[model samples]
Target: MGESVLLTSTPPEHKESVIVSSAPQSRPWDVHRLPSAEGRNFLVTGGNAGIGYFTAEQLAATGALVVIGSRNPAKADAALASIRSRVPGARVRHLHLDLADLSTLKSAVDGLALDLGRLDAVVHNAGGALDDPPRRETEDGHELMFGTNHLGHYALTRWLAPLLSAAPAGRVVTVGSFAARSERLDLDDLQSTRDYRPKRTYGRSKLAQMCFGFELDRRLRAAGSTVLSAVAHPGGALDSLTPPRPPVGAPTPGERLRGLPAALMVQGKDAGAWPVVRAVLDSDVQGGQLWGPRVFGLRGQPRREPVPAHMADPAVAARLWAASAELTGTTDPHLGFR
Candidate 1:
């Protein structure tokens, strides 16, 4: 591991504009009490299930208009209904998004722009994993995990950039994984064409996503853009530990009992959403920083952690950024920063 960058203090010039929370930072951030985001708009990818659903719900509870981006219309409806049931008068909607297919993204984003006009933040929370495989590829010819996890979000961010930049303070929160801690990217083989193992490939893809997030921050700062990019991870969120949402998730009581023992080491998906939520709403959170669970990095309140050495390498990040640009056809000058 290498030395991680540490820039915890907000720059004097950005102190006023970047602050999102009205609550004082005299104490630890309270997850249950986020600042009102009444007029702001947020888009959460894969907000139909897992951590994404909870993330969207938390943001909706803040009074922001939250859009759940999902490939499945039925699932999106279920998620929207769940949020509405929990948060009365919650402003929420859905955007049909299929990250596996690159061709459809522009239209999806165009629809988003037409509906909301401007976007404050986008949580890159959607991801896919293959338990066992002969091998898999995305519709666009990239490996499934790499395509859907990193490149797909990469393209979405590119298209959403203008809308994000339009806001007073825009943020792109890429949800990374603890699994990436031990993984190193073989940039030449980002799609795992030469060597593809389910676990390793998945980890490498997430690592690529993290690099993109950090690299995006560097580019945004260099351009003097207020659009911030931050990376976060859910420690060890298990389905059994998560509270049931009708039509979305309902682990049996026995499953909950069995998962209770795991609580000492892990947490529910709802709890895991804490760090990502904090990354989006915490005014003090700065770009290029990593946020994760505070307790042994497995379960607890959200707190800023040093970017892992591998994850903080600017050289690797730059290389990955270039590859992503070429792969996604985002080489145009105005795709991301402007």
Candidate 2:
């Protein structure tokens, strides 16, 4: 369920570059040293579980007022409880946010608008490869992975720009996937119209996510907006992004043995959460810093790494930005247009 490779996103020289040059195989982000996220307010989409959950928990532990934007209130509540028990006095709240449904997502703005106050950051951490199996559309009638992964966040962030811009030093980090290396933009099949293959669409959608995120940074900076747009790839933060699950069942002993490859390639969600934490909270971190694992990223410790070649392509990024604005009906006033 994969697509053919595109041009390698990594350049020849910096194929496996690390951002913190001296760091080795275990450069985990130290939550204790995280600066005063106190008094700041932030949001983490899909912040109910996995990387999203851990990110919210860690930030809140540092006393940041965090809102976990989850599609499910129940899951959000559970995540908050988990955080509070470990980090006493952690200030975290939950609200409804489904990346699949735009209207449902926007409703929260009016109901629980942060517009009254400045926002410190936002982590666009929700995404999936739902393009697997029978081609399906979200409730909004768009490709599942592309719509939820890219468009949903596109619209949400556009609306939140004012709050973000008003913050003292705002950061918006979009969570991208490593599959992006193999994905290229397909203008003709932006919605997977001509042909629908799950894995191909998933990778392409992720690639689109990175493009949109970086372009967003370019736009914000050109306009001289204080907002910093940093993009992060979870490397091999694996989960069920693309396909439908084939009912929960038992795995054979030998089938279980086959799980080792992904183990080598992927780390637990807790360990994988550091890159986003580093991107958001580390003061020395600069704008547009790319963070992930130093060792193959997918299944190792966290570090700042190079942006993939395709993800950094300007022309492709620009076209995707325009296309995103059209699809989401957001001019992105914060976008810097030269």
What is candidate 1's lDDT per residue for 1-338, written digit by digit as tens? Answer: 01111212435532211123445656678776667677889999999999999999888777788999999999999999987776656789999999999999999999999888899999999999888977798899989999999999999998899899999999999999989998999988988989889999999989999988888888888888989999999999999999888799989999999999999999999889999989988888899989999998899889999888899898998888888889888885335675
lDDT of model 1, residue 108: 95
Model 2: per-residue Cα lDDT over 81-174, one tens digit each: 7666555566788868888887776677555564347678999998765634888888888898899999998888876776787788888898
Candidate 1 weakest ten by summed lDDT: 1-10
The window of 10 residues in a row where model 2 has the poorest summed lDDT is: 240-249
Error of 2 at 187 (Å): 1.8
lDDT, candidate 2, at 82: 68
RMSD of 1: 8.5
Under the 3 Å rule for N, CA and C atoms, how many clashes does model 2 have?
5
Winning model by TM-score: 1
TM-score to true structure, per model? 0.92, 0.81
